[model samples]
Target: MTTQYGTWRKSRLSEANGACVEVARSLRGTIGLRDSKAADSGPILELTRREWTMFLRSIRAADKIG
Candidate 1:
């Protein structure tokens, strides 16, 4: 099925260097992730909303613990 994703946004913390990721949400509520530099030409990683939430929670929890 074709998915229509929202506008991709880079992290505010992203540096000027070419090492950043962009994220967008699909109408199906899934998240789309791609390399900022490559953009549409790059492969996208798709994840469900729950998976994305869990991933963010893990990162934040790791930050707190470390």
Candidate 2:
């Protein structure tokens, strides 16, 4: 859970006020997500590559319908 991540980036679709979430890709094929406002202290969400792919697909599907 405390693995060092690569470059952290926010989605281009993030809110203008900077209340956004950031994602990082680790070398081990895992993804890490954290609150942009608490990069240093906030807890990270770690997900395997497969899980991340599913999560993204679900979001895209939701966007298309909702």
Candidate 3:
């Protein structure tokens, strides 16, 4: 699927500690993720809505466990 992404935005919680990520939504409703530090040259990881939700849940669960 050809994706046309909307505005990519970084999380406000990401301070200058260097662990930054940016996220955007494509016109077709997929999620786009990239490293904010290398945004212009880095690779993007796109995911469907379901994948995005699952990814979030897994990470949150892992965070709680760690």
| Candidate 1 lDDT tens digits, 1-66 | 767899999987787877898999999899998899899688889999899999899989999999
Candidate 2 displacement at residue 21 in angstroms: 1.4
Ordered from best to worst TM-score, the candidate numbers read: 2, 3, 1
What is candidate 3's lDDT per residue for 1-66, written digit by digit as tens? 557799999977787987898999999999999899898888899999999999999989999999
Off by over 4 Å in 1: none
lDDT of 2 by residue, 1-66 (tens): 459899999988889998899999988879998889998999999999999999999999999999
Stretches > 4 Å off in candidate 3: none
Q: What stretches of model 2 exceed 4 Å from their correct place? A: none
- lDDT for 5 in candidate 2 is 90
Q: For candidate 3, give the lDDT.
A: 0.91
- Determine which window of 10 residues in candidate 1 has minimal summed lDDT: 11-20
Models 1 onward score TM values of 0.85, 0.90, 0.87
